[model samples]
Target: MEYIDPHLHMVSRTTDDYETLARMGCVAISEPAFWAGFDRGSVESFRDYFRQLTDFEPKRAAQYGISHYTWLCINAKEAENVTLSREVIAMIPEFLDAKNVLGIGEIGLNKNTRNEATIFLEHLDLAVKYNQQILIHTPHLEDKYQGTRMILDMLMGDSRINRSRVLVDHVEEHTIEHVLENGFWAGMTLYPVSKCTPQRAVDMIERYGPERLMANSAGDWGPSKPTAIPDLIMEMKKRGHSKELIRRVVYENPKTFFSQSKPFVHG
Candidate 1:
């Protein structure tokens, strides 16, 4: 079935990967800015990276007939540098008008530090100011719960934030309930090594029942699978789930959430 992988870092993948994704039924994808293997040295580095995301990556994806949308932010791991973070934030406006640009996101706590929180709030303000939708990244491993909570509290505190316009991603069994209970959309990132697996993602879908929930490959540089969403589709099939239910989770849910964006024009 055709699907959308809502979150994947194509920058880290080969052009052959794009061909594989297209062949596997991935018609569209959204790439959020994240850590680039290491801390970048300056705002100029981020400037070049954003150019790559906003300019180059879209063209690359187009070669395979995939629609590429993107979110811009100095991801949490780099948010520790308040001065540099602010500079990147200020510079992001230069690319907001790009046809493929989505919004400010994958912006949430990493280690849940004070600086990260400060930067997170600032990114929120940027999104609100621009009337843009948001995509968040909750911390992983043992830090996931508290970091997710902290991110939620900050978002809830802001009256300007329309919860439906935000998607808190990387949710597991423990954190998915909180994200959905609070009225925001949730994304389960299917990974080969870490995060949740295809079977466990199906378990969450069974429990959650697919209203404001979706899944993604989150394919990136690490030990991840670009075709992980297809793995999820296979799992749902193995469990005797209907095609309607599978389509809602893998395709419609992301289309609905991304419909709020200025640049998301997928058919």
Candidate 2:
């Protein structure tokens, strides 16, 4: 079945990876700005990167019939550099009108530091001002629970944020309940190493019933499988899930959530 991988770093993947995604039924993807494996020294580095996201990557994905969309923000790892993070957040608006641009995101705490929360709220301010849909990256492993709580608290404190337009991604069993119960969408990142596995993702779907949930490969520079969403489909089928139910999680859920963005015109 055709699907959308809502979170992946295509810039870190090869053209062959894109072809494989096409063959595996990935019709579109949304790439969020993330750490480049290092701290960038200046805002100019981010400007160039945003240009690549809004310009280069989409054309590259089109070669294999995959629509590309992007979200812009200095990730939490870099957000500790408050001065630099503010500069990057200020510069993000220049690219907001790009046809493939989605919103300010994958923006949440990494170490759950004070600086990270400050920058996260600032990015939230930017998104609310622009009326952009949000895509959040919750903390990993041990930090996931508290960081998600902090994020939800921050989001709740801001009355301007529309809960339904935001997606808190990388949710596991411990964190998914708060995300969905509070009226925000959740994403299960299917990875071979960390985050949810394909089977665990299917488990969440069974338990939660796939109302406001979706799955992603989160393919990046690390050890992650780009076609993990298809694995989720196979797992759901293996457990005797109806194709409609499987498609609702992998394809329709993301498409519905992302449709809230004006630049995401792909159906």
Candidate 3:
């Protein structure tokens, strides 16, 4: 049962993650540009970060038979500084043309502030201009509900963009319905502490019926588990989910989403 983790920060992961994922049947991943595990001082910082995604990480994944692709963009938490965010967004197109580059992503509201909203709109515009699929990271905890609503409203208001071309990520029980109902691709992060657990992800799939939706580990520079994706797959199988349904949710959905970008190649 091969899988595609559509949203992870593999740049922050260890080689062991690659090895484990390959052994667990992860064949490909789309690592999105995130907050660098901290705030960066300048655009040069982001420049170097993006290089690691396009250059270093792919080499690491290749050694373990996991094809690595990246979604390049400034993270919403860091996008509050408009100047730096703009600079990073400008640099994204150059990388978007790279071989393993997939799309512009993980770029929605963080704290749900005015600045975050402004940057998110800019990201949406850039994605539309580049004809790239957009991957959004909604806020977490108490902010999750409001942020998800705002992100959906803005996407709806933007007539130039297509909801189907966007993946609204990090959804929970509270946010998943709006995301699915709005005709957007839904992504549930399989994290132990901060996001959906593997069991909950399976429950959501059962309830939602796996249409235009996918799940990822979102493993990154925190106390996050990299094995969450494979765990979800295992649990889903154990629960007697049909192979076709499991394949569509865990493998085919991400492939179809990232396939919108010509640079992405699935083995």
Candidate 4:
């Protein structure tokens, strides 16, 4: 079953991980700009990181026959440095036209602070200005609910945003309804710890019925699995889900959402 891992930080992954993903049927992946485990001090650091994402990572993925797409932003954790965030956002335009570039993403609230909200709105503005699609990261654990709400409110308040073009990721049982019911796509990240597991993700599919919903590995430098989507495929099959139904969640759904980006030319 061929699939797409829509949100993963390949920069933190190894070449062996890429090989393993390809072996497990991952044909394409979209990496979102995220905090590099620490706060970066300057816009130049982000500029260099963007270059790595747009220029280097794609080439690396290509070695394994995987198409790599990317999103740019100063991630919420770093967005607290409002001045630096704005500078990084302003510099993102230089890479938007890159063939592998998707749009502004993995952009949403972390701690749901005022500065985070301000930077979130500014990233929204950048997305709107570029007519780009968005990929959002809701907060973790206890902060997830309110952070998701705050992110949604800001997005809903923006008149220029087309809800369908936005994806609110890391949704759990409590927050998935709000994202999908509001007309935006929702993503369930399968993780070994913290986020939804393969069984839990399959349960969400049973409840939500897979419309405008997708699953990802969210594989990064932390305790995550790059092959989690494949695990999800097996779980769905074991639960008697038809191949077509499982395909819709692991493959078709992401293709549909990511196709909205001009640079994402479906093959």
- Candidate 3: clashing residue pairs, number: 1
The deviation in Å at residue 211 for candidate 1 is: 0.4
Report the lDDT of model 1 for residue 110. 90
> Candidate 2's residue-wise lDDT over 106-224, tens digit each?
89999999999999999999998889999999999899999999999999999999999999999999999999999999999998767889998888888988898999999999999
Clashing residue pairs in candidate 2 are none
* Candidate 3: Cα lDDT at 229: 80
lDDT string for model 3 (214-253, tens) is 9999999888888788788789889998889889988999
Q: What is the C-alpha local distance difference test score of each model?
A: 0.94, 0.93, 0.89, 0.94
lDDT of 3 at 227: 75
TM-score of 1: 0.99
Instruction: Rank candidates, lDDT, best first.
Output: 1, 4, 2, 3
Model 1, span 26-136: residue lDDT tens: 999999999999999999999999999989999999999999999999999999999999999999999899899888888999999999999999999999998989999
Task: Report the C-alpha lDDT of model 4 over 96-167, residue by residue, as the tens digit.
Answer: 999998899899998989999999999999999999999999999999999999999999999999999999
Clashes of each: 0, 0, 1, 0
C-alpha lDDT of residue 116 in model 4: 96
- Which residues of candidate 4, in runs, are more than 4 Å off? none
